[model samples]
Target: MELTLANVMGLVRQTFADPRGAAQVVLRLPMPLQARWAAVALMAVLSAVLMHLMSGLMPPAVGPDGQVLPAISPFFWAGMVGFGMVMTALLAFVVGRWRGGRGELADSVILVAWLQFIQLLIVVVQLVVLVALPVLAPIVEVGAVLIFLWLLVNFVAEMHGFRSLGMVFLGIVLTFVLAVFGMTILLMLIGVAP
Candidate 1:
């Protein structure tokens, strides 16, 4: 199916109703890799901007001399988005294959992009709650994390055609651990860590 607005909405609704089925449908779509990557990048930038805006509502981080610290650079957001997209796709492909799944890199990319899109919508809701009811922000944030994780597990299982959700959960946990380890090594190399 084409990537039209109607199709996207329908897919999102379907995802909420049946994530695994939605993932299977998404895999069958003719979305190109460049388009999938663009979607991920767009979501990343939007998420960063929303987070920055949300942070503005709280007390600013101040230095010992009472000077406010500068916010993160846009370049940092871009780099993070690039790294996340690559790592997500790589992990899904490798782990999925290890589990005897037949999904390709492109399929994994689509799955990750869709997941980001869903989280973006959730972030918008959280932002609204933060503005209208600041006290509920923490609750909304926690709920969003749980929802994202649940959706992620189902989507990963669907994408890889895995019968056991446990395998998908394990894959996600392993991916996260490896990603943290890699980032730690990177930070140490850059002299950002002791």
Candidate 2:
């Protein structure tokens, strides 16, 4: 595939039909490391811009304390997304290898970038649904989360050559729990604990 618009659209359809298969296609692409990283960075910036636009279109979100929260800047969202993409790839590479899986760092990077690309598409759909079909926004929100998790589990399993998505899901859960714990300790140490 030459990364043409039509090819990408076909891949997106295939992704919904078979996430692991789509991941295999993405992983096999002959993209260089620099190109992979650039793709991730570009997706992060695009996602941030879209998020800012979506926030502007939607009503203000009320905080738990009954105060309206300020909208996050696109720069901050971009930094967060970019960091998350890099860390997710690194974690998948390190943890999967530790679990006796066979996968390369480059594979992880490209797959993560591909996942981000799919997420951008979902965000666009969400934007449209929020405007034209407000009543179905909740369904779209739930569906988006489900689709994201499904793709993520399949992508990770495909990259690591894992046979059981159940185990992959468990690994993802554990990793997320540990990450949250570590971040909490770091925040506490820095006197920013909530």
Candidate 3:
């Protein structure tokens, strides 16, 4: 594809019309490598700043070294959004690229943001659960997270018209299981996470 402003704008427009399909194209193909690097850098910078800000929001307790605890605030939420979108964008790219595609980066960002919006819906429900239905928090939160992850991954895959839903499902399940396994192994080695 010719790299022009029109093409970029078209990509953006096409992405909006059918984001999941457009995303699959971007994620799976061997597209221009520049966007990947750009995305990763953006993700890293945002992640670092957001992590710092979010950490400040935590309810602090006395440390073993006798330091005063910290407090968690509602600041830096946009940064937190940056952090989340970057993560989903990476996931979209990896899963998309793995199956062979050369899609645009902007589309990937859109998918990331769209999925993030869905997650926000879940968060709203979780918040309501906390306030009005405290006993349901764990169930709602965990179920919503798992369902959202699968749905987002699948939706992103569907966008690119590459990896099948089954493949995405297997990929996600395998990825999750392996992550757990790897963490378990590492923790076992270090005497953690039983």
Best by TM-score: 2
Between candidates 2 and 3, the lDDT winner: 2
Candidate 1 per-residue C-alpha lDDT over 44-146 given as tens digits, one digit per residue, 9 for 90 to 100 = 7876776667677777889999999887666676578667777887888888888798888888888888888888888889879988998999999999988
lDDT of 2 by residue, 1-194 (tens): 79898999999999999998999899889989999999999999999999999999988999999999989999999999999999889988899999988989999999999899999999999999999998998899899988888888899999999999999999988997898799889999999946
Clashes by residue pair, model 2: none
Where does candidate 1 clash, by residue pair? none
**TM-scores for candidates 1 onward, in order:** 0.87, 0.94, 0.53
Report the C-alpha displacement of residue 135, candidate 1, in angstroms. Answer: 0.8
Rank order (by lDDT, best first): 2, 1, 3
Model 2 C-alpha lDDT versus the unseen true structure: 0.91
> Of the candidates numbered 1 and 3, which has the greater TM-score value?
1
Ranking by TM-score: 2, 1, 3
Measured on C-alpha atoms, candidate 3 has an lDDT of 0.59
Please report how far candidate 3 places residue 115 from its true position, in Å.
1.1
For all predictions, the C-alpha RMSD in Å is 2.1, 1.6, 7.9
